[model samples]
Structure formats: structure tokens, C-alpha cells
Target: MKKILAVLAVGMISSMAHAATVGSQSYKDNIEVGGSMWIPFGPHADSAGLPGVGVKGVALGQLSKISMRSVRKLTEQNPDYGATDGNNVTVVTPPAHGKVAMGNFNFAQLADSNAEVYYGEWTAHNDTAGATRSVYYVGKDKTANMPTSGTATYAVKGINQYSGNNQLNGTFTADFGKNTLKGSLANNALNVGVDAKINTAAASFNGSATAAGKTGTSQGHFFGNNAGSLAGFAKFDDRKLDTAFGGVKK
Candidate 1:
């Protein structure tokens, strides 16, 4: 019986590995469309020591070619990694000119929970040395434990899509009683403000954002003990900017 159980365990591991390998190609193709790649959004635990960090980069002509090959390979290795429309991946560095600048969150890992979202970066290179980097977050919502009436502030990190992955730092405020959320993420290049309605049962929020007289939409979710953390993604309709942001309650 012991030997049988051991063999079954091994088989299960092997089957999972095979599925991941087979699924990666399809997932990559689905996410990368017309020079745009999907990124996951929502609250995530800072597992792997990589809390979500904002990135800034320049767009080079070689970005599309390099990122496609690199991201596919990374997905092949991390079958569990996935992407969604909430955010996007922008290729930054070109390898021929210099070594790709590595960032703090430079590798992909499996999500810590059944519900998942991801953050990522890329390195441009012609050879196999080029690769995409990513991290996963567990999405959690403790509705019962969530405070019914109160206001809290969260410090956030933002990625500016219009300004070559411009990094925006800012804060968000949530009012539980009002079922409303508001915040602004900004840098010298741009500033965006968001207002949304919160759905406590789902531990999520969605609404509109405005920047420089242009309007956009935002969506995100709450995470952790009693919904103590929040994260979101946004995009402008007329402006070339998109953003991802998150922070913990203080």
C-alpha cells in the first residue's frame, strides 16, 4: 500500500508538470495580442518578497519582437502564471545596446491562493538569455471581518503606461460606510484620479478615472485579513496611459 501511494503521488506531480508545459503556449498566444500583453489585476499578498512595484521604461522598436519570445519562455517555465485585461506588459530595454536592466520583481512564481493576479517586467535580448519576470498574488476577502464603517488610507505604486512605463507614487482612501473609493496616482509626466463604488460582498471595486480632462475606467479587489489590502488597474480612454496600484491599510 505504501509503494502504491508513493507511485500515485509521483504520477500526480508528473501530470501537473505535463499540463503546465502543454498549457503555456496557448496561454502566451492568448495574452499577447497586437503588441499588447494582458496583465492580472487585484489585491495580492507580497509572497516571494516582491510586493508589487511600479516600473518605468522606454519603448524601443525591438520591444515587440524581444518581449514575445521572452515572455513565452517564462510562461513555459511557470505554467501557473496567467494574465488578464486589467493590466498590461510593456517591453522596456533593448539588449543589443546594453545588458537588460533587472528589477526587484524579476521572476515568476505560482500564485499563493486559488484566486490570482500577477505583476511583471521584461528584459530584451536576442538570445535565450532574454526572459520575462513576474510575481503572483493571492486574492482574499474577509467580508465578515471587514469593518462596516470607517475610513482608511493606503500607499500605492503605479505604472504609467503612456510615459514609457512611468512610475507614479500616490495614495488611495476608502470609506466603508459610503461604499466609495478614491485616489490619485501621479508623477511629473501625468496625474490620474479615480472614484469607484465598492462591492463589499465581492471585495472588489470598479469606477471611472480622470486625467487631464480625459476619462478612463478602473477595477480592483481587496485582499488579506479583513480586507486589509487593496490593489487596482486603470486605463484612460483618450490618453496613452494605463496604471496598476495597490497598498495596505494603515
Candidate 2:
């Protein structure tokens, strides 16, 4: 009997590799939340490759619930990436822009977090597209710190626009456990003609994102007086999980 069917196919490949190594070690010991995030608003071009001035629209949302709690752990990778290590991520917007709210809080440790590293702060408020209100404050200190292996390097500041205009400043850095994320932006006179026509700019942007899918790409550049100076780029070609209690969730 063909050696007992090759020992039942090697015991079903050793029980599927012990159930994927016990589901990646129980996704690194619990604190596993779900995911869904999408950000797209029209008339674009504040920087990073310009080009979107045709007034379109698309700003969908759904993060229904995102919770994670796994404190203390200096090693043993994969706990849902340490429940997004030093977690704090909020995005609730759905009422056609007027229901805008954004947040990012880590307070400390997130280059990759090997311990003794800090830099994190981001807050944003909004009222989508036909803008009526907007606000943003950002931070990421710890210029450079290293305790013999627990690396660090960060610098960022912020002030956003749309509430009387003219206010946009940004900076970036990363290197904790190195899943990498970068940034850059500068603006001070973007009064798009109401007879004020002011436009001064400086831009450099980078992108790399991951959770399961929907890759990344972003680029920008735009110069003053609008006589022509623009560049743009964007790519995140795949992501789908629609559920208003219907079907689709994968």
C-alpha cells in the first residue's frame, strides 16, 4: 500500500506546519484588532507631485473598531507587530467630510521599539471638502538616541491649513525596528486666488505602508505663481472590504 500512502502524506505535512507555527505564535500573544482605512479627497495638490485640479471626490471610511493592548515586551517578535507597537491610531470620518477627526498617539517608542526611544504626537480635526474647519498639531522629538542597540532618531513639527488658510509645516524620520515611514512638507502662501493669489512651496514626500495589502507610492512638487510647476504621483492599487451589513470582508 504505497507505504501507507506515504505515511498519510507525511501526516498532512506535519499538521500544516503545526498550524502555521501556532498562528504565528497566537499573533504574538493577543491584542489583535481588525483593520480598514481609506483616505481620498479631491481637488488635491498641496504638494508632492501636484496634479489633481479637476475637482473630483472620494472620501470613504470604516475602522469601526481598532483596539490593542499589550504593554511591556522587549523581545519575541510578532504580537500583531506588538499591537502596532506603542499604539494609538484613530480615524473616524463619515458624513461627507463634516464628520472629520484624526489622531496618532504613540507618545514614545516606535522606530521599531527596542526600548528607550521616543517620538510621537499627531492630532487633526476636520470637516471634509467644502471645508469649514480644520486643525493639526504634530511632534516627534528625540533627535537621536541610542542605548547600545535600541536605536533612535526623529524630528517633526506641524501646523495644517484650511480655516483662513496659510499654515502647513512638516518633517520626518524613523528607525526603531525599521518597518520604515518617512515624510516632508512646507507651505506658507497657498491662497489659491480669491484675488490674493499667493503660492510659495517646498516639498519632498516618501511612503511605505503595510498591514496586509494596499501598497504605497507618493510624490510631489509645486512652485509659486502658478505659471507652471507641478509634479504628482499616487499608487495603492488594491484594497476592498465593504460592509454596510451586506457581504465582502476579506
Candidate 3:
């Protein structure tokens, strides 16, 4: 029985290795790509004409290409290395240029909680050889331990605007921020092609989303009608994923 079990384990390992070999190759190719939201936003975009128009400041860093042909493989060797343990993800790097010359926050996203599941922070190589930058949500609402209904919040998670629930009606920007989602940039990116356009930019923001289990309004603040100021949840829904999020600033 022990020998049989050992053989079975070996077989499983071999199978995984085979799959990993094949999957890694394809995954590397598929994963080594500039995400749809890989624009030059964040602080670098500058808070100048933001919420208005024009350059939206000017993206500090734009991940033009990601070469996953050779990546850091700590997860493969150590089980507890990365949080995801997928061992498929690789560090992302910017090509030649597209990075703004200003304040830091370079690979800030990598250190954020979101990077645990999504890609880790994308450290930049501005000053040194590697800096980090994870994400700049056009919109995402993350609460502290998922608060009850009607709690004022800030901070978004990702770029997925249009988050809906029973009570909450997050009317996202609807334009995907006009930069990556509505301009020549997104229309000409890798993986995310022109067809990847988010045609339905939410026109109406939803306020008051109830918890999936709770019958009463899910307990959260509804960014109601407020002109000139953003009002809506972008990254999450009602199941505690909802919170006050400022999707796109520029």
C-alpha cells in the first residue's frame, strides 16, 4: 500500500509537472501582457485638470509590455512564498518609457492588500532596477472589516466600475475614465483590444445596497446625487465588498 501510494503521489507530481510545463508556457504568454487598465494614472497623472479633462495630468508609468518568459519562481520552490500559491504569476515591468518624473508610489500597489489576489505591486525601476505599482482603480470600494449599512468610506479596489446589487445602484463613470477605456490607448493595447471597450458606462450610480443576507438595505452609504463630485461604488457589490470608492479622478 505504501509503495502504491508513493507511486500515486509520483504520478500526480508528474502530471502536475507536465501541466505546469505546458501551462507555464502558455500562461507565460497569456499572462505576460499589459492589462486593460495598465494606463499612466495615479498620482503621477497629477491632480491638475483631473475630474475635468485634458491630459488627466499625465500618467507617470505605463506598463507597455510584460515579458513573463523568465520570471521569479519563489512559489514553485516554496509553498508559503506567495499568498496566492498559484506559482503562475510573474513580476511585471515597464518597457522603455511612459513613466512620469515626479512623486513616488511607484510600486505601491504591490504592497497593497489587493495584490495578494490580483497581481502583486508592479515595482518600478525608476531610481533603482525595480520599483512597484499594483493598481489604480477607476473605482473600487473596500471597507474595514465590512461595515454595516451606512458607513462613509473611501478607497476603491480595481478598475471595474459598474458594480450592482439589490439596493445599491453604482452608476459608474460610464466612460471607463476616457483614457484607457475611451481613447486611442485602450483601443491599441495588448490583450485588451478595441473590442474590449466597456460600451456601457454606468449613467446612474447606485446608493444604498443591502447585505445579501440582511433584508434591510444592506447597510451602506449611497453616494447619492452630487454634482461635480463622484458618487457611486465601483469595485464591489453588496456582500461586504461594497464601500465608498472614487473610481476615476482624472
Each candidate structure's TM-score, on Cα atoms with residue i matched to residue i, is 0.50, 0.17, 0.18
Q: What is candidate 1's lDDT per residue for 97-119, written digit by digit as tens?
A: 33333222222222324222233
Worst 10-residue lDDT window for candidate 1 reads: 18-27
lDDT of candidate 2 at residue 112, scale 0 to 100: 25
Q: Please report, in order, the local distance difference test score of every candidate based on alpha carbons.
A: 0.46, 0.21, 0.21
Q: How far is each candidate from the true structure, as Cα RMSD in Å?
A: 12.4, 22.4, 19.8
Poorest 10 consecutive residues of model 2 by lDDT? 241-250
Clash pairs, candidate 1, are none
Better candidate by TM-score, 1 or 3: 1
The prediction achieving the highest TM-score against the true structure is 1
User: Alpha-carbon error at 247 in model 1, in Å?
Assistant: 1.5
Candidate 3 regions off by >4 Å? 1-76, 79-81, 85-120, 124-197, 200-250
